[model samples]
Target chain A: MANIETSLKEAMTIDGAIGVALVDYTSGLTLGTLGGGTTMDMNIAAAGNTDVVRAKLRTLEMLGFSDGIEDILITLDSQYHLIRLLAGSQGLFLYLSLSKSRANLGLARHQLRKIEAELEI
Target chain B: MTSGSDPYQSVRDELAALRQQLTGVRGCVIAGVDGLLILHDSITGFEPHDVAALSAGAYGISRTTGSVLGQGAFSEVTIRSKDGYLAVYAVGELALLAVIGDSGSNIARLHLEARPVTQRLAEKLAIETSHPFG
Candidate 1:
């Protein structure tokens, strides 16, 4: 099983990986993080993303539907933000922020799935 | 609070379990639509109140997003950060589950696991509200 730290390191190796962190959406805290530099602030970014996760969950409830959320994708001019909720770990999720210039959305998604499968936590 | 027969109990229990399961997760909380705390299992620096407030904020954003898109309703929302990600899913009319994780977490799988529980809770709420005995 891949430990959280190793998983994070592997995630960084992805072509466009700028920074990575393991966050708890419920509390808006990062359990682990890697790669963000002067250009980005991982803490602030994690906190804000917490809001996005909460909003979508709220919307799902109000709609009176029972389906689950798969993943959330945000496309910016220079970045692709991907949020993948972890299965079996209720209230937990994975957040990936990639540089559009170097990341492949399709491949990133695929790789994330592979990592999730091997992740112990 | 309803009596022993309260149908909302199931929903509450489910949320509690979710909180427990995510014991290692930081900055995550399960809350009700009214911003009341249902469960808080944060492993980071945030307070329970802060998590609740963030959940409320997400609810507001979701409402606005629904309006703009002309969609009948909103389901889930996600925000990405340079170092982490936040995601929220609607469990039922009475509850919402929010998660904050690092960029390495698998959000997609989280959603899949949460969906069934949310659906079950919603049904229990519906039945309890619909029946006088409940």
Candidate 2:
């Protein structure tokens, strides 16, 4: 199993990855981050995603749904933002940004899931 | 306080109606952004004051999380457990509305029914805040 930094690094290795962050949603802080540049603002993006997760969670509860969210996807013109809440940690999540042109959505999601399962806090 | 003169009487009535409409609802508490209890019903077992304090506490971080992330405004938060659900919604600019429902209850229905009531309460709270002397 990979630790926090390793898990973040592993997430960066996926195809079309622009950046990845291990975030504590409760605090809106990133525990670890990798591969962000001038073109991509990791801080802003990662912090903003906590709300997306929050909204969906609220929606689920209001809808009376029993299932927990596996992943949330936001598609941009040039990018795909994927927010995955960890199965083990209730308020922690993995944020992965991908270049739509270079990444295969299916494969990237699969890899992220695999990494999430092996990730240790 | 006299019901005829009290602005909160309407809010209290709304809460009473909400309890009746939501099936298996455990209880509810409307709290201020600062964590003070404005109103409550049933919502037993849990301390009413604590529920208010915690709602404000959770809301602070949740609102910050929303603003910094560009998710617009923080609307509502829900924590579901084995027994049931605890849901909180932002009421206007001054308060929060929290509803507790059991496993057999439909949270969606509660939210649907409670939203209008929350809006009305928020309006009253807003009026009170704007005209404190009145």
Candidate 3:
């Protein structure tokens, strides 16, 4: 299994990846981050996105959907923000931002899934 | 002697008892919703003030998210780090509780023990606010 650092490095190799972070949605803390230098602040984004994840989870609970989430996608005009829920972890998620013009959504999703599976803490 | 009117005597006792009852708990802090520290156990590494403030911000966001999404209300949030866990719970409409735990901490036990503490503290805070001069 790939470690967190290795997996993050692999994610950067994806087609349109601009930045990526491993976040704990429970506490709104970013464990590790890569890229997103001048364009975005991964730390702030990590905390902000925690609200999104918690809101969705609460909705699912209210609706009686016990099945967990796999991922969430937020598409902006110039960027695609993908949040992949990691399995076997406590409220951990992988957040990736992509340049819409350069990214292939399908491929990026597939790659991120692979990375999530291989990621070890 | 510090006046017996110290509003937080029971609150302090509750925090101390929580630490004594649990293993791996590093520290605990009680703060106002405005991010002001009310009481804290001996916490190392990070500043309790910073933790209190950030936890307030976190609580506000979570509560709003819960309400706006029709999920009712937010009760608590738990953050797991590489080395430990940080959990924040709403003490009442006006305050919050933040607990720091080590990696080996028993989270289930922490929740079981901490939840009741919040309730008792909430009641105490309500009384304190209603009788500032009592």
Which has the greatest TM-score? 3
TM-score, chain A, candidate 3:
0.98
Per-residue lDDT of candidate 3, residues A1-121 (tens digit): 9998999999999999999999887656678999998979887678677767877888999999998999999999999999999998578999999999999999999999999999987
lDDT of 3 at A38: 97
- In candidate 3, what are the lDDT values of residues B1-134, reduced to their tens digit? 12476667888888889888766789999999899987798888889999999889888888898999999877998888898988899898888999999875656557767889999999987877777463
The local lDDT score (0 to 100) that residue B73 gets in candidate 3 is 72
DockQ of each: 0.04, 0.02, 0.02
In Å, residue B91's CA in model 1 sits off its true spot by 38
Stretches of candidate 3 off by over 4 Å are B1-134
True contacts kept of each: 0.00, 0.00, 0.00
Measured with C-alpha atoms, the lDDT of residue A11 in candidate 2 is 91
Q: Write out the backbone clash pairs for model 3.
A: none
Q: Name the weakest run of 10 consecutive residues (lDDT summed) in model 3 chain B.
A: B1-10
Interface RMSD of each: 8.5, 11.6, 9.7
Model 1: per-residue lDDT, tens digit, A28-86?
66778788888887766776676677778879989987777778899999999888777
